[model samples]
Target: MIDDIMSSIFESGIRGRYSFETFVLNLLKEHIAKQDKPFSTNEKNQKLGDGYAEFGFDRFTGPTIVDIKGKASKLTLISAAFGLSARLERACADIENLSNYIIVFGSRVSLEQRKLFDIQLAAKKVSVNKNVNVILWGLDDLDKLATKHKKKTKEIVDNIFSLRLEDAINKSTTDWISERDDLLLKLKSLYKDGQFSLFLGAGVSSSANMPNWEDLLNSLYVKYINNEFSDEGLIDESKISILADWLSSVNDTSTLMVARYLRKALLNGSSEDALFTDQITESLYSNIGDKANDGSPLLTSIVAMCLPKRRGAKVKSIVTYNFDDLLERQLEKSKIDYKCIFSEGVINSPDELPVYHVHGFLPKEKDSFDSIDRSTLVFSEEGYHYIYTNAYHWTNLVQLNSLRDSSCLMIGLSMTDPNLRRLLDISARSTETIKHYAFLRRLTANRILDKNHEEGRVVIEEEVISGLLKRHHTLSEELMKDLGVKVVWYEDHKDLPGILDSIVD
Candidate 1:
């Protein structure tokens, strides 16, 4: 019977499965109503109602509970335990007592399991008093229940098409805006101190059309395998991914690999005696204080660094995991006087320099043949060790520490990447004066399916938006308390490019 229901689900698609669940719930509600029993709504209410599936009774018998199990093959035993725990917690908190339930959904509940559940109930392991009743239900039980309550079941089936699943998903569950606002204010305050440094991870580059280190290496492999590299066999995808993963947002390995890879892939060879060495030598002299092009702003988010210049306010530094020169480009475009440093040999320390490229740039060799052998550019484990182990390497841990002691503005970073997460933790611990602000992007679930309507004014139901705020918004608060890091969640990245500049300008 379970197999038959699952088969029907597979054949009917997602909508069909949802319809079946809805029909079952409605049938249960109708039956309870017919019995004319008192149904206890139990929600004197605060926040989201009881976590279990809603159940109704004929009269005010108190919270008619329904233990709902939404099943897909992906639902694991661990998830089941978590779900049950959540419902139990909600029940004890809101209703002040457990209630009767009608368990439904999932093929896992066989007859044997049902008998065990019954036994558990008898033993008080599963009970309304404990808020654990309405044990698992099998497909066979649902089929039987459908047969027993045929009239009520048919009404639900007939009205299934009109049911709004979207409404359920969009239901509001939490109030988390205060948390979000607190984070943003802290971020705003942190950036004002101007002593911190930034460590951008792949999350930052997500908007810039650049791939993460792992993806970049994967692309390199693809290019190499197809004759892009001289020793294509030497390039291992797994090894590259490992190296990329191991390097933190602010690590010696990061610069080494980037510089090495860029030299090899972009400059055609190693940087030793490379043609770009001369260009580096010249850009040092002639363009020492040249402004960047308006089109390609580097040192972006510089506005985020600006604060009312006091006599002793410290200058901020930037450490990017990115391969592009956009940050420097922005600084230059803004005509901000600052030293420019990269992982490569070029290090400008004219005192007022604000940005540091932890990862070096591609060689500037004018002549293709004279360029550093591209392979010599950093991208591998050996390269990461070489430049970092050396004390004189550009933007080493020391420099990063120096910058980190000040307040930092982190933009375009995902909180999940291990590298950036480590940097945030480390920097927060080491820097006494360092507070950090991160500009995070928020994604809204679109209700309208039309591609054209995706960009238009689509309402994100209040409930749905609130629920998201509850879960993801906590990141902002936790970071503040734990590391003194402040993160502002923004609906659009394009709107606040000058979070950095707003302070400095």
Candidate 2:
């Protein structure tokens, strides 16, 4: 029975498989829903749900679950167990209180394979203190699930599978198209209302071929070491890399550590601030010279939005986490009037755009602008500590004001920075509804199926992917909501320009 279902899913050109999906979704929904109140199938509820194919029930009233699996390879089983473990954790926080946990296979399980799965589950041993119950839903035990729960399977399967992949994807369960349309309208409204502020992160600079902070630190470290070793003879890049590996082996997230060392040693610490700034500025633009001036379509579109309209509201402020001057260079090329504000006493002139460099500024130091604030660069551990610990810091006030006052459109940001998250939290808590926006790609579920797209094969597996996307979208929206922002999701980065273009000028 399960064999036929799998065949229908992957090989058969039939939509009757929809029945199986409906059946499975229904079963899981029924099993996990609250008993007293109506349980919504909102795939996005993080506390009550997993990404897509899984559901997490509240332990207070939910039953002890015995997750049953169909016949699968060891790898597949292991993968499912890991997923189930996460889902179970979301449902029941206390594993020691978990009385029974079973794995029922639709096929036979060898002792070795059984041991393997036990070991896999034993991974929880670090947090789990009590023995877990395990039961097998063997071949004779698990036939009911896959055989067919509803009639008209053949007809439904034929109809669903008949549609071309593109058509199927557009009509997938997640319905991101409608959601995207809604987001665009909201963005346009914000832009027209003059409430939109732009927040840029490292991703924006990389598009122009600038090295990320970590890579910049790596390069700077290599150069600084070579200079220091000039008397003994300079070491090659490979040797510098080896030394770096030795230093960062213990902590994978040692970018800050590297930055701290460089801030202390490079250009002889803060005593030679001018030289340090020059070194960093040279490193940033040496390889990517004039490349950023060309500007990407995404960047161009962003710049267009910044241009003043004949009547409507225009971009008033821009805040970037990058230390490079790529955005400013583009603004200059486009002939848009903008000012770079990086210090305490400075502010943009009236009727001119303000580009706030909360991290610091290291422009190419063109003839027009000879002086810059090198001391404001926030790259090292000490710099971050200073800003985070000092609430009254000028940069903090600037960032806090951006979130607290306007509807910020964040691009090229990972949204993982704790400092940014803290600011967002404060902004969200302070306001009733901030309606800030950020662009993020989907992990497992977000899929873009463009009928007019000239590249790549048509996407299949609409049923599964859509389910996954629905969960992803919901959770992302909810998560960002807590941070006072709305999530604008794209399955592929290429779709970003088109989506951004949809925003009205």
Candidate 3:
């Protein structure tokens, strides 16, 4: 019997023109109306009720009124509900017998949106009649009603569910398009003015086959275990840094030794890694090495994009947490003169682009090509602590001056990096108006979509994507308040080059 009814619904075809509210009203009349005292819709009540109009209430049983709405945008639905509340308040003032009021939506409501609806409804009731009972019915409640009452109504329920999902996706896509346009405008203005300093993080060097912070630390720990320690029991999977520190103590060597091993490993494994090395001469008379001229395409493109906008003016300073010389090499190849400042008491030339290596840079000399100076590089927990404490140090002073004077554009950074957190902590105490911008990738639900979610999935549902976006937006707001950095989100890294082109071209 149920199969026959579903077959008929399929044959009839659910057209967009069909009124979902009228269909639901008929279903209520069949299942809810008493046989002797028969409930009816507003259309039927027109002839029997007192010479009053029946426009707002779709269905009613005596003094109880029910309002039904089809799938709609949140703003449209909320506005309609507010209008209904005002009408109800005016009606209750005239009609003392009206008591029960139920509002039903043929779509889903988010938990936060539901709470807002309840608060508004309660306020409306307090203004009307304290004794009046108001009930809100979402898609879940309608599904339960279909299951409990009649099997034939299931076809209508399924159609409404599909329509609601479509409505949600359309709304989210429209909102995202509007936001992307606004962000593009802001980026263009900032780039044209050259008021921002670039803050490069580890992600910028990953394209050159450089190991990330974790991988670099883990590589050092493995080398330490092999060369210095025989027992692997000292390895703490949660804290790779602690193990590296312990290995340095046991070997009676500085943590800089571990850093050099990781750098050598990175250089030996990939030819691309050589592009990030510092300039070195074999002898006083010998020519500079090929590494000095070679530039990473990633860094070169970034420099090319920003350099043209300066129009003979000095480009904004570029500060990096990376120890590599990629930015310096790229700037030199572009014929844009830049001052490479690493130590304290060095006066910067206002005519040249200032490239500050805040963490430290690899030292290079004609005779020291095969050897790296450990004292120049900052690595390990102790090195970081020393740099942070010594305010007069060249690197520390340069960073403090940049944060105080320039608006920063942070790139290739992860939100969870400890260095970024520490920078924010320092910026928080500043009395100057410090504005910063960061480029972040948008969160997607693809990671959470597994085989279990593939049954009816054509695409990820809007609700899942919306939740991820909301979570990131909340975090962005917190970062804005605490760090004074406004995040501009991109859908993918591939989109970054085009965005940069738009800003400077």
Candidate 4:
């Protein structure tokens, strides 16, 4: 039980320490001598401590300050110490008050370092006019608290998995929204003026049952590897799981490298020559299966933007990184005049909403639409190389023109692709007018910590997760600004449609 509790505590990110602290806070709430109730998180933050227990029910004698040190840097300790001291001093609370100061270190501390820190802590407590009882507890000491309160410990462990921090997280996430409303309003006002264009990415189609980039590449690798053209292949589809397992766990190669190899094998196969776009289309639709036509709210919002409500409103132009023709199909079903642009020389009429398929288009091949040129599909690693290396490539020119000329609102793009970022950077650096905008999701502890826990991976540093929770939004904002794209942050993917609706409403 001690091992289990401590394992979670050290699992990295804000999960372990925060969970334990909250658990301890709950225990204090049920304390026999607490001040009617537990200290609120807001109070804790104000005090620079996880919590300070105000024991002694009859008289309310004092505050037993509890500090949970997940990572005990000298600076952090000193800051906590001096900060607490200053806070107590400001309150004019009597020095040598009845309450004790408790410091819980989540990891091993060297005896020399522990003694030195303890002395400093003692001095701080004395300065605060506290009882001077400085209890510095290490990992083993933390176990005693859990071991002593077995039922409470179990409750805390269960609470961690159940996402007990949600209320606090929701509160923190909500605070960021109002400040971002101005940007959303600015964007909507521009859209009202017919000044904004849409730059859509894979994220828009994610909910429509399309595989992500990694999954798509992996699926293609599996399909091509088992093809009749391969010299050594998994012939029996019954053994597909084994093949997949090998690819997932045993294969150490990168996704792009594996994709490149698999694509080349299919291309050079002895049987029917497999076109890259056709292969992609097959893999894509296979994943989409029944959800091929079931568009996501994000997609619906984009489709709505393409055909505006107002009589004289200009139809919004779109530049998409996706290869799927869901957008084309959506527009077609609405009977909206829209042109699919994949070819270099293809010119869109002024009356038609232009949907540029910048990557390549191989929509469910059975669907009747524009005749796709095999050369136009940038569907393979080699294809990517061709466009990336060639400065004057048609795809480059198309994207560059859009980036340079339009105030494109980017959706579902991570901006990780160097080629895309390069184009964005170039356009941004060159222009002074019409800055771009993106809807960025703020990174929360729930994602990194909970995901790692769910995946059975060792949780990384708690401080890292906590620091990112506190700082990543600002950091991401600065990063996007560097690319000349202003960010409008949302809390979750589910919030995306609403964000889109807010801007387009």
Candidate 5:
């Protein structure tokens, strides 16, 4: 019996470590702790019962109350709903002490559960005559949080033996919603006046028929295998490029380590030293091409860029991290007078339409445009570090900051990528613009976590797309909220074109 109990405990511990709820809560806490004036959260007792409140002291803003929910079922994947009771109880328009914010955190909520939440909320509104600002943080929130903290946050989560939900609230994610809301409101105002720029990332591309990072890596692996390369003979294409680029520029210890990792990934058990030669790596390096690198979809992106503005209204400048000249191509085709900053043609002309590529680009030669070889693209850890350390890095950022100052309509991008978010954060700080919108493409209806625990069976789901709005229209309503940056989401990519056309018209 004791052995069984021990095994159960060990299994439970593992589940909590990898559970989605734990992952998100930790990330929230991590960011909150980094703020200039630390935010604080304390357990509060409301008329309904025990709830939580989050307050920010940095300056300006109201308090936020959070009612956290925990669960362990697949149906709870969509939204965290239980915390509403506590949040509703604590929610008051005028709090004597401070501003209030309400947040809900939990596993997931299924479709059926979401409907029930809506019905319950409606009943509460009709019978009790109270409006509660209940914010649901479910699977999508967890996924985004996990993606943002993939590196450092993962380590913290894996070793979260001492951390608890209460600990996270006090440490990282602030319960301060007024400031966040204010920033969002400012973004909305900017959109009304037509100002903002967007930094599209892989998440945006994912909505446009491109594979994600994991999918891209897997596809590359398959390509190698199909080309008659053995499993043990596999090599990371990005790593090879880094080595080739560094070797071509300046030789150092990094070059050796790069060569070793390439060797191990490729010819680990092989007796043929000839197979591990530089020529082999060079050949392998030629296979990589940025599918989004070309300007094939520039016209579409331009349409998106033009949609927010009135007829003939154009942004002061545009910037993208994409290697392809899609935006440039579109502008050229449309006779839009814009300078291609990524190309050698605009390298010395910083005053022209600024398009910066921090990671460099393909199709252009080194001396031809300040671009390095294809092998040197920032696709791997080594490649990223190189760009992260560039001398002109601050200048590139200053340009991005300029764009951030303008209200941006973000589309075709997932907010999950950590590096991308970091870039957004940098631009936000530089420009002091806190308002931005993100369009979510793939989202779960419900989720479950900590199934191994005794109290893990908590389930919550909310069907709140607003009055007269159904589940099908929830994304639209949520995206269109006037509080912050307004987001207009589509369930399918094909729908995006029509939506863009409508918005533009």
Candidate 6:
């Protein structure tokens, strides 16, 4: 039982030596008392050492030099070995009668490492007299001694061991939300000072039935083919983007047409959809007039939590990669006035919040649908190349300026978009001043066990999934490092509103 307890403690790593040293001293005192010999703990004096071991008779064994150590890494162990060797030599030469040196470690040392220490000490050319000896007491040796005198020390060992075990278990099970209180505090500080902005991505709109990149492209393809393509045919859905690219080349048209189709479809319109002026106006009015419910709209709830309650307060700017007007609609509904800037323009009014649509927005005017501006939307390969090459582009300028000036909180962002990643990298390299933050969903393991399958097959499938998750986690860490962004992970998207609320509070 004692060996099992000691092994567990060793695996967990010893933290500090003060408590262990005090316990050892108390045990030594009790042992001396049982033998009817006087024992006194030497006062701590840096000039002398940690403590000294003294027996009443000088002839039996002179005062021993004592040192206590916690478990350490390989480099630390080497340093500890050399340091102890030097201390031993100095003490023996200065003290009156030091006969032995005793060192106690919280964990055992491997045989190879022990031999290395001995060799290092021998190389130091320290003289060893006939009466003096060096003693190393590891956990195993200490346990044996404590158990041999079981009646006196058993309670002390059990009490300390149990407390440490409970602490370890509690730490392992605690939620990350509780552990990251400091990060929350920092966010709140930034928000309160009005030096923070929000950079939103498609993830923020996913809850409102927004289509993802692939899904949006697939929808456009279906619409373009007039629903003639059979879903069961050899059409590979994964390659839909490539197909769109091919369509653009064949028709001698830009891929921006595809984006236009997608936006029109989202507004519940057909190819002849000229404008969404009516829908935009209705959405704007309804959101402003409607009372807050059980937070049915995720984006609106987040905006409400962030917006200042007092009238005429200046709101922080919001930058988004999404082309949809969801955030703008939410702001309008809350009666929080904002400027939607898709191109270069100054906000003449300081009271209204600025929403920079970096990727472009759907046309609000009737004629915009009839003659769409291909340069505004950044969806095609050529569009992305042009935007990135032109440093003075309005979208690039807004994103770079935001990164340089304020600490941004990126929400619903994957850090996977090439354009977004390139812009961040340029800012990080040029300025390297501000630290940005993001909220991501923590990756978790899934145990795959098909009840109808053979047991062996189930085990194999589980292992494969576990391996993939591990690799994904490693790659994610590398990407974050390159981007120089710190991420706070949550379990679910539903928790996002609460997280935003906590930051504001």
Number of the top-ranking candidate, with lDDT as the measure: 4
lDDT of 6 by residue, 41-70 (tens): 544322345456566323237676656666
TM-score of 3: 0.50
lDDT, candidate 4, 1-505, per-residue tens: 5677666644443334445555555554444323364444445233445565555322235655666665565765565565656655543454235466666665655676666675676876636553445566665665655676778767766775343344244224435677688778888877777766788888987767788877787677677656652456536666664676576555457555666666676676544334655777888878667676778787787777777566544435788889887877778777788888887778888788888888877677545665575436565567788888999987888778776666779889887777888787777655422368887777777788889999999998978787666655655554565567777777788888877777767
Give the Cα RMSD of candidate 2. 19.2
Candidate 4 — which residues are off by over 4 angstroms?
1-174, 228-235, 248-254, 269-274, 432-434, 455-464
Q: Rate the local accuracy (lDDT) of all candidates.
A: 0.47, 0.64, 0.55, 0.66, 0.43, 0.60
lDDT of 4 at 225: 55
- The 10-residue segment with the lowest total lDDT in model 2: 11-20
> Could you list the CA RMSD of all candidates, in the order they appear?
16.5, 19.2, 18.2, 16.0, 18.2, 17.7
Best by TM-score: 4
How badly does each model clash, as a count of residue pairs?
Answer: 53, 7, 1, 6, 40, 2
lDDT of 1 by residue, 1-505 (tens): 3355445442232334344555555555555556764332223431223223233344324454554454423233234443444555665666544565455554555565555455544554432345434445557667766677766655555566443242233332343356455655665555555455666545544444445555554444343333443365665655654544443333335544554553455345554544534433333223222332332221345433532256433455656655445455455556666654553454445456545555444422324222223323333445555555654554456344643566555666666543345445555544322255666765544422243366675665667665665554553444442354555666666655544444444
Give a tens-digit lDDT track for model 2, residues 79-148: 6556655655554563334444445443556777767766876674423324433444454333453333
Between prediction 2 and prediction 5, the one with superior lDDT is: 2
Q: Over the full model, what C-alpha lDDT does candidate 6 score relative to the true structure?
A: 0.60
Error of 2 at 375 (Å): 5.3
Stretches > 4 Å off in candidate 2 = 1-173, 234-251, 267-270, 445-474
Residue pairs with backbone atoms closer than 3 Å in model 6 (clashes):
287-333, 288-333
Looking at model 3, residue 286 earns an lDDT score of 24
Count steric clashes of candidate 2.
Answer: 7
| Global fold similarity of model 5 (TM-score) | 0.41
lDDT of 1 at 194: 48
